[model samples]
Target chain A: MALHPYDPVAGAALRNVPLAEVDSKDRSLALSRPWQLRPSLLASIASHGILTPLRLRPKQNGLMQVVHGFRRFEAARRLGLPSIPGLVLASRNLLKLFLQALEEGRTARTLSSLENAAALRTLKYRFNVPEKRLIEEFLPLLDLKENRRTLRLHLDLAVLPDALQQALERGLENETALRLSGRPEDFQSLCCRLILSFQLGKNRQKKLVEMLDEILAAASKQEVQSVEEVWRELGCAALENRADLTPADRWKRILALLRQARYPALSRHQARFDELKAALKLPPPVRLQAPRYFEGSSLEISMTVREARQLDGLARELKRISGSQEWEELFRLL
Target chain B: MQPYKPEKVFVERAVAESVITRNVLGNLPMAQVEWIDEAGQMVDKSRRWNPSIARAKQSLVLARHPGRFFKPCPAGTTKTGRRNVCCNYFVVNFASNCHMECSYCYLQAYLNLPYMVVHANVEDLLDELGQVFSSNPRSHYRVGTGELADSLALDSLTGYSRPLVEFFAGFTNAALEFKTKSNCVENLLQLDHRGRTVVSWSINPPTVVQAEEHKTASFEQRLAAAEKCSAAGYPIVFHFDPLIHYPEWEKDYRSLVEEIFQRIPPRSVPWVSLGALRMPPRLKALVRERFPRSGLPLGELLPTEDGKLRYFKPIRVEMLSKMRAWITAASPQTRIYSCMENTDVWQKVFQSQQPPSEVELGDSLLQLL
Candidate 1:
């Protein structure tokens, strides 16, 4: 096989380059930044300096571009080191250098979700890789399915704002973030804020996003120029932004408002059921449960007692409840 | 309606000399045809294409079905493991995918093969059916060709109905039903069906036909075709299988029922089937993705025990009961049956009468035929 003069595997050699000559600003091939470096890594670098050499290619302007070690270079930079060891490659092929750096980046550590997007974006927009090739070749390389849908989703994630990308790194789901990426910037900001503040679980996060999307899609165009206005119109704005309420309470309130708006009939039935159950005034130990979605015409009654003596009182309460008018009203609700 | 003219056609090497292949290729003089060693590879690769399901429909495949062609109707037992009061119906799948794009088509999620396939080996299908039917002379089998594909959607190209109609005419123990949403009845108009083939249309209100049933016949076109079939001595049936619910559904469905009775003689209408809109949950996402402007996904749907989503019980009951009332008011003699519904729904819709058993229902329909 033909070999180039600046082959990264064969021709590359380690050299100590000065911090001034090494340009870390050009991160066109970087998969991740050094934003949240572990304190252990910082202490290691502080004690022993950089143990591994960074990959750098010489630019035409005579400055060495950091190719694969932004995190290590950043550690040395913060430690105030004069110079760091790096492998210098003089290849004229920028794409080859980028791929070499990508391989080295993968070998060093597992790339975060956002870093995967970054690598895909660099291959796509920067190198002008065709979508078909990305879907077939690069997606599998990045541990994703080989399909146009996966490619589009990664590309969409790559283009979101930095805050949203960081949120993805910090536990926001890829699918939920992708759904938000297509919406207007204001809407994305609002939803991201809600998601982070509430500390919602995965299911609640998905439900919140889906409910918001459905409500927005069903709104009249002229009436909903802004998502905030829709929130205000639906009476969720004040409840969500209430300072005294806990995050759980706020999420519950917002979800209730959205559910009521989205499914008026189902919510109305639920409200009536709640009212009838309240009117029944069953004993605290006894519970009356309606069927799911009121899909069936049956109701369940259960009682929890700490002692056997409580059963007599519970049975008397149940007997009284069976003859109550509210019991019939509850059945009618079903 | 625009005639289905696929941009390309893939013909498997095995079926290159089949009659259905020859007829279909002969009909499509403008299509670019490619011969492949096998159909499964090409159909499998088609799913990887961009906009997989929609793009797959732009091409057609004429291949031999490599498996059994006859099976019991899957609609009898839903995916959720709840068995409905199923008519003893059988399905003869002559095709794999449908060309007409309905927003709520189960094929969007149910079928792994995205491209439309026409099984060209009709003689094998006939021979298998002959053995099954002749072996059981006392058993009456009610079979349909519309399980996986529309019965008459590709009739002009494949000309499958002629052979099927002629074959079924020779069997006194079997009846063939050509269920479709298309008005493509020209092929069956002159066939000697001999009181064996029942031409059925899956009818909806014009509003639904316009909004959801893309690239299919209009209400008037289907009614006209049904009238023509009745005049040609074939029994006619209507299926309101997916009775979509909306604010004005009652008025629209009532008008639809009244118009059918007003035009065609109700005596010729042996039975009409009512089924509410129920689909696998995955199909809901596909419908929402394909037809964003459609209101189908916005309805009040809940997951039933069958693992398919349907309108809430009261909503379904209201829609089906009102539809049953309208049809009964139109023609008291025409029988009404619920398709894929439980005993409770049947009792409510048929009020005061007991729900029929599967054998009883199947036998009653066969007796009418």
Candidate 2:
């Protein structure tokens, strides 16, 4: 359903109007945010500023439907502007007008508060819109240029992890949220906790993603059925990407899963414990796993390089534990 | 008053203020009194050119610091200091200023001058070199004289390269590098072609040379100079050290690498150092504030432990991987290094696995020398 310039914007417009003095109409606000608000979009918008103005129509409720300035809208929002100038489009007119805008080389903002992959797919099929146009053009066009630095088509995909893509749906434009979608269920919560825990440096964040990519890439390239197999597959080169993650965190998680105990995905916790023990001149006794959303099925370990010493240790421990009578009864049937 | 008559020049240097010389000494190597001729050039009054004591003293007084004067270089690290990174190295400054003013240069932050400051006391400089090299003899000392000033900037006047080339000759363990953006190869070409001294050039993508690095020789001219050094039996070095992080960086770097190997055989080239465009921390804001059109993006940046903002580690890793892949394919044996980076990167891109400590790096490079 096309949003009538009368819907959200009209809803926003009439939101503050007193019932006694209110009429339903859309109004536009003129705004531009500070240049730094957009990490990589200023130049594009400035280049865009040279192109053309967005055409938003006015409704009586003082809300405006964005006909353009998708870039400018985010910029203004970043700068804390309440209302932005936008051309209002009634629900009845949005479908044809949107087609006309594209035909005229006049693109509207990528987002019109009408983002839902299911809806977009339906819209694409019904309108015969190209999938690429929806992803490469319309999506980015809808976002204010400032928010586009880290925005990509994944946010438009329904199959991505629900917990991970929540921020994108809430209009929070950040790469951290986008990256978490790829994590197994076990690490999804861990990723968010880490983002909120420490000030993650850009390099740190990039390295983590690259490490995950390397793992995924390795899995796609080879066949593996066992932990040992995964280790052998990773090779030494690919493991360096995860070198920064403490060994203890890595060890404990695999052990806890094998032991059927809850585990934590963040290795930084182990690193902290190690750091304290080191300062105190005490030996690190054992790995600690903080139970949250961790489970072995959530794991997507691959042939990317890793020392896998802990995995080896776990195998040895499993052998010793199973050798005992307490372990014998556990797997006696299997 | 035109000093070098009959020679048309785009820029000229004059005596801004001088205090070192009580009077004039007529024995200075690259200076002379001249009168203007019909071609708007300088004609020397004397038959022989000599720099007087007065001239050397004048150059010194002009270069004096108004305050404490000495601050360590922020983004300055040699292949040795940069050891365990994409390379292991360090750089030193034999001169303090440059006469050429490229709009992109950071010399203004270090020196208080518009004129070149050639260290007149060769003995004191030798003493400093002696102390450094003696203490580091077992290590390969890959040091360059291009930090505070263009290593070859004042060679025409002071003839500093002659002594430097001679100085590094005895210190077989120390690799003395003289880097420049100028084609002042005349003084350098006469050296003994010792394997120790690397005649390096700080070049950029061609159009960058024309636009930002003003008064510098063209890319083709500089490559020809490298070719000349190669023919002299001297191993030459090339640096795209300040590889600008432009929108078209991939195209620019690829073209440069292609041009270099195509023009000068990879064997004749001693090494190539590919550094991302970086500057001292102080200069970042200054450059942005002063040159509004700098247009340099915040490109995958991070602050070093030492505090210089740089291309973050992953970005650097990605950059080096691409660069090393290209170079490794192009000239497999030629040594490639990075300036002032860390050890993890060295291992990742170069496949070094285990890099030497700073001292070990110095010894290894020196042994090669």
Candidate 3:
């Protein structure tokens, strides 16, 4: 069998290192490793012990620093294991060590979008990888388009605040999070809070983000300075006192306020239409429809009939509706 | 005029032999090039392409149009006893998509191509136009290139208008119109148009342009360009289509009309069209998705008989009546007409209960030429 030159175990010794003596100073740049430990992995480590050895290198302080297997070290410490199996490497190539950790993460299915972005950043800044290679080679590794635009969006996602990153990790969509991140920093936190409080699904989160963005644009057009001002003008705080409303209901109310702010004409048209509909009070079988956007000069009245008697009944209903002044007003509105 | 700089250029192998394709490639010297054997394959591949990122990067495609280059306008007869179709109006599609983004643009729903495509086979288009023109030499034809793409938006790179203007110059029966929201008329100014080409602008109020028409020339810029065209012995036209119903719209539109007449002579402006903001039912969702901050699609819209969404009749009447009044006051000699409107709207707007015959309306516009 041929020995691979880049094997992790090549010229390295496997030994049990005390978990307390392992330093994580250089771990901040590890792209593949997640910040928070997984409960399933912790439970597995507690029951079956560490199967893979942690990759470690010696530091100037003489304490071994973790190069990979950060989760395993944390889990072992939590399990009260004084020492964990570690592979001690003599090499100090950060890029090679980071790639090795990334490979392990791929095998373990732990590398997320954030991790992918971080790896691309490390390759670009620390290792001086060309942007062309990053876009063409690294973006596809994360199932993103092999383009500079996607690369930039993923890079933007990498530096988001920790809370938003955690939310992303907990399954808020990357696109939704990206949209939220495009807002002002103050609005981003407020939006994230609303999203977390309601526990919105991906579609709802997208809608919320869109509605918030529209509100912001409207406020900007109105010369309102901040989202805080929008919130105050919209009376968003009053939603808190509606104790009977569920989170979804509260979210709906908030979205309605935003929509009203965004589309003043549509709101007014809707109110007038509702008033007209109420005034018409047509029979159950009859329906009156107006042209869309109110841009065309046509109104349609539809009705259903089963027999001659029903036809006569519909005609009488139509006559009654026609006789009402609301009919004239409706035509005038049209 | 500032030429459009596509980030990447894709040339179809079929159009590689075309002169227009070579011209486009030469114009965009720094663009990354890709060659494909079939234009359909490229179109199919672009269906999955995300324009949000690509458009931000200014990536574009230059390919040959695989289908017919010339076709009649689709604004056919409506159920409301109105001839919505413009008689004898034909479209010469030099391109498929626009680089500019308007919130209420129907192209957002109409075009599926992810990138802006300039059809490279313009010589073939001219040949087709020749056949149509010769087949009906007696009838006056209103041919336009702005149906799908903005006519002047890519004129600097494509140089399509020069040949088109020169082609129509020989014909007394045919006139070419280039409708656009762009100010790229510098190329057209130097051409021997011979009063055969009409350079028109799709204008709106400054506020509406700012809010909805993204990456487009400002209203003042468009007006200045129109004034230049008018001075350069070319007939000018104005289209105030997709007139948005917003707060202070009357004030905005009135001032817009005043500005137009104040700048360009009304005698040079032969026609002015008014079309209210209306879209198909499916376009509402697309607009909301593509332009999340746009309030244009949130108007009080209901489906009309032809399956397009439009405003209620009274709203349309009010907008058109006010526009007609303002436009007439500004320039009484400028002919005003409505596009895609029914007979009732025409009667209400023109203050004539009797609907005019389609022939009369068509002749009225033709007389301007």
lDDT of each: 0.85, 0.50, 0.78
Chain B vs. true chain B: TM-score per candidate: 0.97, 0.73, 0.93
Q: Rank the candidates by DockQ, best first.
A: 1, 3, 2
Residue ranges of candidate 2 with Cα displaced over 4 Å: A1-334, B1-92, B102-104, B112-115, B127-140, B297-300, B351-354, B367-369
lDDT of 1 by residue, B137-254 (tens): 9888999999999999999999999999999999988999999999999999999999999999999999999999998899999999999999999989999989998888988999
lDDT (0-100) at residue B106 of candidate 3? Answer: 78
Runs of candidate 3 exceeding 4 Å displacement: A1-14, A28-35, A38-63, A75-159, A280-322, B1-68, B73-88, B93-125, B147-163, B180-196, B204-234, B242-248, B262-268, B276-317, B331-333, B340-364
Tell how far residue A48 is off in model 2, in angstroms. 57
For candidate 2, write residues B1-369 as lDDT tens digits.
Answer: 001111111111222222121111222434443322221121121112334312312332212222222223334344224322423455555556565545556664544333344434455566776887798666456677787878775566556677778788777767777888877778777777477788888887787776566557778778888888778767778886776655677888788888888887787775677776655666654554444334442333345544455664545666777877787777887667776665655666667766556555444444543
Model 2's TM-score against the true structure: 0.44
Each candidate structure's TM-score, on Cα atoms with residue i matched to residue i, is 0.88, 0.44, 0.71
Ranking the candidates on TM-score from highest down gives: 1, 3, 2
- Positional deviation of residue B342's Cα in model 3 after best superposition, in angstroms: 8.0
TM-score, predicted candidate 1 vs. hidden true structure: 0.88
